[model samples]
Target: MFDVVVVGAGPAGSMAAKTCAERGLKVLLIEKRQEIGTPVRCAEGISKKGLQRFVEIDRRWISAEVIGAKIYSPDGTEVTMAEEMAGNEVGFVLERKIFDRYLARLAAKAGAEVIVKTTFIGFERVGNALRVKLKRMGEDWEVETKLLIGADGVESRVGRIAGIIKTLKKSEIESCAQYLMSGLDIDENYTYFYLGNDLAPGGYAWIFPKGNGCANVGIGVLPSIAKANAKFYLDRFVEKLEIRGKIVELVSGAVPVYGEVATAVADNIMLAGDAAYHSDPITGGGIANALSAGYHAGIVASEAFEKKDFSANFLRRYDELWKADFGWKLRRNKRLQEFFLKLDDETLNSLARSIAGKNIREMSIEAIIAELIKKNPSIIELLKSFLSP
Candidate 1:
C-alpha cells in the first residue's frame, strides 16, 4: 500500500510525487503512456520566475530564451511590450519532452515509485483508506492508498470518478492546435501574439520561437464563438505571417479555463493541474500553475498522513492553499478574458493604435490602464482593478 498515489506523469503529477516522497511519504506515480512525455500539446513557454520556484532551469530543455512579446491588432498594427509591462511573457520555450521526463526523473530520485503504461481505472472507498484499480498491459490490479491525487489532463476520468465535477461546459474550454514549423524567417527572440475577431474569435494566435529556424505556431479559440476549428485559424495565421516552412510536428488539445473547480478535494482525494482547471483564463497557460498547485497538494497530502486524517474535511486544506496562491489571480484574469471577448475588431485596432510608439518599460500597470482609459473611457470601469498597487 502506498501513502499517496499520483495519477498522470505530467508536470503536476511528477511534482506532487517528488514533494510527497521528499516529505517521507510512500508515493506511487503512474502514467498511462509508455513514456513520460509524448505527443506534446503545450506551447511549452514558461516564465523563468515561475519555473525557478520549483525546478532549476535546465539548459538542455530550453530551446530559446525570449525577452519580450509583440502584440498585433486586427488591422496588423503591432505593439512591442517588455515583460515589465505585463509581468509575464519573458521566459524559455522548452523542449517539453525532455522537460517532462526530467521532472519524472527527479520524482524517482526522491524515492517515489514510478510506473508507466498503467491506466487508472477507478477507485473505491474502503473505510478510511481507498482501493485503487488499474489496468497495465492488458492486466488488471489494485493498490490501496491513503490519499489519491488526480493530475490527469482536461479529460480527467479521475476527477469524475472522485465525484468532484461531472461535466465541463463548452464555453469553459479552449480548443487549441499547434505546429512545429521549420525554415521560418522571423524574430527568434520575441514571442508574437496576434489578436482579432477574424484571427481567432474569442481567442488568439501565438508564435513561440524555438530557435534554430523553427518555432511552435499555435492558436486557441473559444469553441462557442469559433466559426471554424482551431486548425483553421492556425493555418490562416501561418499564411498571413508568410511562413513558407515545412511543418515538422502537429499538436492539438483542449484546455480548461473555467476557473478552479468548485470542489478540488473530497474524502482522501485531491485534484491538481488541468484536472482542477488550474489553467490561466487569459493566456490558457497551465504549466506554471500546475507545478505550483502540485507542490502545494503534495505538502498537504503529506500532512494528512502525519495527522492520520484522510477525510474530506482534512483534505480541504489542499484546496485552501491552492486558492490562496493562484485562485484569486485566475478569477481576476477570467473577468479580464470575458471583457476582451466582447471587444470588436475595430476596438482591437484602436487599442493597438493608442499604444503605438509608447514605451511600456517606463510604464507601470496603473499607468498603462490610465492611458487605455483615456483612449477608451467605456472600459475604465472594467479595467480599473489593474490600477491597484
Candidate 2:
C-alpha cells in the first residue's frame, strides 16, 4: 500500500512523486517503458527561469543556451525576439533523455519507489483508498494507494478511465514530428520558427539549436486542417533548407492544445501534465507547466493526507491552486492561439513584416507587439481583448 501511486515517469510524474515523498508519503513512481525518457517526444526547449524554479541549473542536461528566437514570415522575412522577450519556449535546449532520468533519480532520492517497465492498468475504488492496478514484466500487479496520479502523455489511458477527457477532437491535437539533425549551418544563439500555411498549415516549423551544428528541427500541424501529416511537412521543410543536414534522431507525438480540463481532480485521482491538457495552446510547450503542476500536486496530496480528506470536494483545492498558478495564462493563450489560427498566410506575413527590419531588438515583448499594432493598426481589434487584463 502507498500514499501515492504516480503513473508515468516523465517530468510531471517524477516531480509529483518527489513532492509527495518529500512530505513523508509513500510514493510509488512507475514508468511503463523499459527505460525512462526514451523515444523523446518533445522539442526540448524551456525557459531558463521556468526551469530554475524546480532544479538547479545543471550544465550536463543542457544541450545549448540560446539567447533568443528568430520568427520567419512566409515570405522569408525575419523578426527576432530576445531571450527575455521570447517567452517560455526559448532560452535553453535540453538533453531530454538525460534530463528525464535525472528527474526520476531526484524522485528516488526523495524516497519515492521508482520503477521502470511497470505499466499502470487502472484502479478500483476501495473505501477511501484506491486499489491501483499495474502490470510488471508482462504480468498483472496491484498496489493499494490512498491517491492516484495520472501524469501520462496526451493519449492518457488513466485520464480516460477517470473521465478527465471525453473525446479529444482532431482540432485540439497537434501532430508533431522532429529530428535531431547535425552538420547544419545555424546561428547557435537563436532558435528559428517559420510560419506559413503552405509550409506547415496550421502549425509551424522550428530549429532549436543544440550546439556544434546540431539542432532539433521539427514541425507541428493541426490534424484537422493539415492536408498531410506532420512528418510530411517536416520532410519537405528540411529539404528546402539552405543547409543540408543528417538526421541523428527522430521523434513524433501528439500534443494536446485543449487547454486545461474542467477539473483535474475527481475523488482519489488527479491529473497532471498532458493528461490534464496543460500544454500551451499556441506553442504546445508543457515542460514548465508540468513541473509547476506536479509540484502543486505533491503539495496538495500532502495536505490531503494531513487533513485526512480524500474526497473530490477536499481535493478540489488542487484544481483551485493550479488554476491560481497558471490557469489564466493558459486560457488567454488559448484565445490567442484561436485568433492566430484564423489568420491567413498573408495576414501572418504582414504581421511578421510589420516588425521586420526594425531596431527593436532590445524592446520588450509587449513593445514588439505595440510595434505590430503601430504598424498594423487593424490588429488592435483582433488582439486588444487578449492584451487587456
Q: What is the C-alpha lDDT of each candidate?
A: 0.87, 0.87
Q: Which lDDT value does model 2 have at 213?
A: 96
Highest-TM-score candidate: 2
Q: Which pairs in model 2 have colliding backbones?
A: none
Writing each residue's lDDT as its tens digit, candidate 2 over 1-389 gives 89999999999999999999999999999999988989899999887877989888789899998777788888898897774543333478999999999999999999999988898888899999999889998999989999999998787888899886766899998999999999988888888889898899878899999999999999999999999989999999998875488999999998898876789998998989988998988788899899988999999999999999998898889999888887777887777777788888888888887788774554234456677888988888879765465
Worst 10 residues of 2 by lDDT: 359-368
lDDT of 2: 0.87
What's each prediction's TM-score?
Answer: 0.94, 0.95
Worst 10-residue lDDT window, candidate 1: 359-368
lDDT (tens digit, per residue) of candidate 1 on 270-289: 99999999999888888999
RMSD over all Cα atoms, model 2? 2.5
Give candidate 1's TM-score: 0.94
Q: Candidate 1, residue 281: CA error in Å?
A: 0.9
Residue 310, model 1: lDDT of 94
Instruction: Give per-residue lDDT, candidate 1, residue 70.
Output: 75
